[model samples]
Target: DGQKVTVIATDYTCIGEPVEINVIVSDLPNAFTPGSDGFNDIFGAGAELTIFNRWGQVIYEGTEGWDGKYKGKKVSPGTYYYILSVFDANNTKTTMKGSVTVVSDEK
Candidate 1:
């Protein structure tokens, strides 16, 4: 969703023109490669992210990012479900659920 914010300044006898700002929230990537080549090595969406495997088991949870690992081991390349929670500028929390695929460039 797109939201707009307006700001204005006023004094005892004067008022400045109002300014409009657009707030745009970006969507997380559908996939990432944890190969550590400095590109797409970590996946994250918000301040908190919880990822689960297809079997409904929690695989990863943290604020930092997921390196496609579980229990310090790299998970197989595949799709994983995730729940992301984030706070906006006003500290309003929003939660999102989606899937993200883990990719590997290694042979």
Candidate 2:
């Protein structure tokens, strides 16, 4: 799981005072092996995960994470795109986008 974040603004009165908002995208592990032994059953990063198909259609979206399945069925091994959004304690949002590959057990 990713770390929890916090943000605080000292001066809320100042409009466009150049508030320094830091956005950091942690490099999560690119791949996970979700075996059927009840360990690592979910194959996704801990942050908010959004998966898009090759045609740019969002296939899955959730906060608990992706379990390498869609609509209660396992997805075939292939490449997919993911967008992870992390929010700080002060409600600052940071989003990270990347790609990942899912491999079958035989491979």
Best by TM-score: 1
TM-score of each: 0.77, 0.66
lDDT of each: 0.85, 0.70
Residue-wise C-alpha lDDT for candidate 2, range 5-68, written one tens digit per residue: 4554555676443343444557665665545756555645456889987778888898877877
Q: All candidates: CA RMSD in angstroms?
A: 5.2, 6.5
Model 1 C-alpha lDDT per residue in residues 46-94, reported as the tens digit of each score: 3699999999899999989888999988899899999988766666778
In model 2, state the lDDT of residue 23. 47
Q: Which 10-residue window in model 1 sums to the lowest lDDT? A: 19-28
- Predicted structure 1: lDDT: 0.85
